[model samples]
Target: MWRDLLPIGRHRGSGGYRRFAWTAADTDCRAWFKAQAEARGLSFELDRNGNQWAWLGDPLAGDAVVTGSHLDSVPDGGAFDGPLGVVSSFAALDELRRRGAEFARPLAITNFGDEEGARFGLACVGSRLAAGQLTVDKAHELRDADGVSLPEAMERAGQDPGTIGPDPERLARIGAFVELHVEQGRALDLSGDPVGIASAIWPHGRWRFDFHGEANHAGTTSLEDRRDPMLSYAATVLAARQQARLAGALATFGKIAVEPNGVNAIPSLVRGWLDSRAADQGTLDTVIAGIEAAAHEHADRDGIDLSITRESFTPVVEFQHALRDELAKLLGGAIPVLGTGAGHDAGILSASAPTAMLFVRNPTGISHSPAEYAAEDDCVAGVVALADVLEGLACR
Candidate 1:
């Protein structure tokens, strides 16, 4: 699966991938998904919200036992983050076919769009819209860094921008949704296990902080006379680290932009985004509030204007225990239950369906970057694990 996808969206310089949603590369990936499904004699259907579903039997016959994940990647992100779940879905189907397994209920593999929010600044755009969490009007208004509106992007992809919205009928068709993904962290490595069941997702959010200052010639601006917003941003970054450590949460100012970004000119504005997560909402809120307060203080003292906005927030997601237990029982009694710090479409879909996840071990304990990796053997284990769970759910 990885080899087949290596050529698509390959970043030659960094050896990572840039499969941002709605782009030509992403479109190629969707085509690949359709081809793979059709080769196996499956019927493919694309929902109103742009999510693709490949069915092994009649989709409308019964509530479907759905599996699969997104294909989009963060800029220069690792190979396994989104695509792992997708290929694993196909691999599981291959395993079932090899065994000649028969199914009673409908089974479908899905590819969700824009799960990373890397392009449009809203994670789970496809799932959120399908689940009725985000309205079409608001979604159409979203803009990317290049100032391309969501509606325009949809139009570029041959979709009606006006038709993007919650699909209650489609959402109702999912009996249970399962996703198999590479472990984004080292919990599995620490436990000496190759696979595990996801128990919950930590609450997480993104905040944008924009600081205003004067742009001046670097040679002409004196240290004492300069009101540089970058200083406040730097201070906020440090405060984020400290507050997260103190509160036992995770906070990172990973994305930033500086206006008038020439080396010879002082930046006029600094826009930085904070990504934070915690075991509970209270700790997450406290850590964020602390960082915000410290940033405000720094901005005031430095004579810099500051503004902050909550771009998105997802509360802690606890998977339905019955589904989790059922999957564990199917996989085997000894499969470990785990919780993840990273967010996923499965986490978003949990609100609308009985959702669970299977995670393959990642020796690198890293994600969202090129260094993330999973051994081939572990990936195959994930495929078999998923097939077992699906058979238990749909093949009775």
Candidate 2:
């Protein structure tokens, strides 16, 4: 399955992928998903919120067990982050079919839309809409780098923007939601294990900082005559790093935009996004507040304007303890229970479903970048573990 998906969005230079949501690569992935489901004699549907679902049994069956992950990738992201769980889902099903395992309840493999928020600026957009956390109008208004709205993007993906909203009936059908994904950090590597059960996810959020100033010719503008917002932005970046370091939290300015971005021109406006996460909400909030105050001070000093807008925020998510314990027991008590700093579709789904996640070991202990890696053996182990959990939950 991994080999088959290699060419869809593979980057030649870095060998990483750029499968942003609703792009050609993402469309190809959806087509591939449909073909895979058709070959397996399973029915498939694209939900109103743009999530793709492939069912092993009656779609109307009560309390279905669902497993799968998103296909979207961060810019230059490695092979495993989102696709691992998707490939594992199919592999696990193949194993079950090989053994002729019969399920009493419905089993579904889903590929959620926009879990990364790489293009839309809103993570978990698809799941959040399905769970009724985000209104349709607001989702449609989200814009990308080129100023294309979400509605426009959805139309390009062959989905109706008007249909993009809460899917209560569909959401209600999920009795249990289990997403098996490659671990984004070093927990499993530290334990020298192939797999682990997720215990919790740290509180995380994204905020946008916009600095306003006057644009001018870079070579002609005198230093004293210019109000450069870029300077304020730079200072804010440093402040974010220092504050996060002092608070023992995580803060990153991974995405940025400069208006009229040109080497010969001074930018009139600078916009950047800050992704912050911490073990607790208090620490996370404190670190962000400190960074914001610093940005304000820099803006004041530079004679520029600064504004901060929160894009998204997810509080610390503790997986249902009983379910975590149940999975641990089902896995023979050998696997470790671990907490993660990464946010996931599972974290969003937790608000509406009994959500749990199984994490496969990542050898490199890195993610959201080309350096992330998980061994083939570990991936196969993940499939088996996921299949075991499905059998216990979905099969009679």
Candidate 3:
């Protein structure tokens, strides 16, 4: 399974995956998922929001034990971030069947769409829609870098956007949802464990900062006469780093756009997106407030009009204690329990159902890049751990 998926969306130059939502690479991934489901004789399903599901036993059965993760990637993302959980899901099922496990409840594996939000700037769109955290009207307003609407993208990929909305009935049928993923940080690696359980997700959000100023010829305009939004933007970026450091949080301006982008011309507008996270809500709020105040100060000094818009925000998600404890008990009491700054579909689904996550060891703790990786032995350990958890949960 890993070999079949390794080359699907890999870029030659960067050696990273580009499986953005509803793109050709994403299509290939969806097809691969369908084929895997069919080969395993699991009933295949595509939910209203384009999430893929493969089921064992009855579809209408209540209290279904569902496992799996998304397959999409961020821009030039690593292979393991999303795909690891999905591949591990299939492998775990195979392991369970080999062990001759008898299921007491229906089981399903899922591939939630647009998990990375690399295209639409909203993470966990599939799960959020199903959980009703995102409204239909707001969903219709989502657009990509190229001005492609979310509904249009779904339609182009052969999914009915009209049906995209909350599916409480489907969510209600799920008794428990477990997502196995490669650890985005070094918690497991530092603890010398191959697998660990997630305790909570940090409060995180993305905010867009737009600084508007005058455009002029870079070579001709005097430094004192020029009203440069770029100057204000740069100052704000520095301030963000400083504020995050003081607050002991995380803040990054990873994406930006400049109007009339040219080397010889001053930009009229500079838009930068800030991604910030903290272990708690109050700390995150404080950090964001500090950064925004700094941005305002810089913009005011530079005579630049400033506007800040929150693109997305997710509060801290504490996983269900019962399920989390159960997973730890199944994996043996010696396993580590840790919290993470990164967000996942498991966090989004936690609002609607009992959700938990297992993290595989990542030696370097690098993610969302080509260098992200997990050792082969660690990956196999993850699969076995997931199989054990599923057996304990579903096989009784």
Candidate 4:
């Protein structure tokens, strides 16, 4: 069951999963999913935004039960980061079938595309587009690092970009959404537990800063004669750290690119992205405002032109407590609810729909890398917890 959900060597022995959506690895994963759904007698349907759904009952239901997660991962993300929830749901459903439990509600397992933003610059692209947060035009305009526009990529993948847009009729069918994911951090482990109910997700967003300066020969220009944009970008990076530290928030300067990058030439321009988050929008605003101020200051000092553009911002998300309570009781009432500093597709759905999450323990606190993990026992426990949660949610 797990193997079908998670193909080993998603990164081909890089000790990490590498299923960026629409890429080779991700497409393979999708094909496996189609096979699994067909075997289970579920009908496969692709939505306007490339989100795939496997319906277990009447496809036209206005309020069906929804359970699943993304299948994409960071460049070298661990196995459980994305696929665990998607797999566990299928496994749980299989177990449910064995018991022949009487059921009346329709169910579906979905695989949302570009959830990690590992390829495209925006995260949760599929869900955002479906929920009307991202427009079809802008989505078509997005490109990967290799300069492949999202529309072109979709066309290449046998999908029509013109048909991608808000999917209210499709989304309204989901009565509630439950995503089972490996605990990206060590929260459950710290509590000495294998599972948890999500309380909330911190607000998070991404922004890009572009700095322009005159490119010149490294050997011909003295230190005082150069208006290097790299200097301003460097200063901005340091300031981002300082501001996040001062505001008690999370911030990162993870991706950057420099024009005329060479050993003997001063860079003419540097463009980079900043990822920032906090528990509240006010705090997040302060964190970003401080970084922007610092960037302006650094640009002035270095005599460089600077521009900062907002990419995407997700507000803080609070999971459905009624469902969370139900999950806790199903898991023996000893379950805990924890908030995450990271953004998630579950969080995005919780904005307009009733949504909750089950988090499996990770012994190591690390995630978004190859070192993330969940022991075998923890994995089994997570499946049990998911089964319990789904049984309860579907029954209601």
Tens-digit lDDT track of model 3 for 249-305: 999999999988999999999999999999999999999999999999999999999
Number of backbone collisions per candidate: 0, 0, 0, 0
Q: Roughly what TM-score does model 3 have, to 2 decimal places?
A: 0.99
The alpha-carbon lDDT assigned to residue 11 of candidate 4 equals 60
Which candidate's TM-score is highest? 3
Can you give the TM-score per candidate against the true fold?
0.98, 0.98, 0.99, 0.96
Whole-model lDDT, model 1: 0.92
Error of 1 at 138 (Å): 1.7
Ranking by TM-score: 3, 1, 2, 4
Please state every model's RMSD to the true fold in angstroms. 0.9, 1.1, 0.6, 1.6
lDDT of the candidates, in the order given:
0.92, 0.91, 0.96, 0.85
Candidate 1: which stretches are off by over 4 Å?
none
Candidate 2 structure quality by residue, lDDT tens digits, 1-396: 788887888899988889998899999988888888888888999999899999988888769999999998988888888889988998899988887888989999999999999898899999999988899878978999889999899998889888888888898899898999999889899999999999999999999999999999999999999999999999999999999999999999989999889998988999999999999999999999999999999999999988899989999999988878888888999889989999899999898889999999998888878888888888899999999998888887
Candidate 4 C-alpha lDDT tens digits along 1-396: 675556643666677887776777777778877887898999999898988899888989656778888888988887777788888878878877776755578889988888999888899999999999898888878989889999888888878888988888888888888898888788788899988889999989999999999999999999999999998998989999998999989899999888888999999989999999898989999999999999999899999999999999898888888877877888899888899887777887776688889898999888988888888888788877777677776654
Candidate 1 weakest lDDT stretch, 10 residues: 1-10
Give the top-scoring candidate (lDDT).
3
Q: Using lDDT as the measure, name the better of candidate 2 and candidate 4.
A: 2
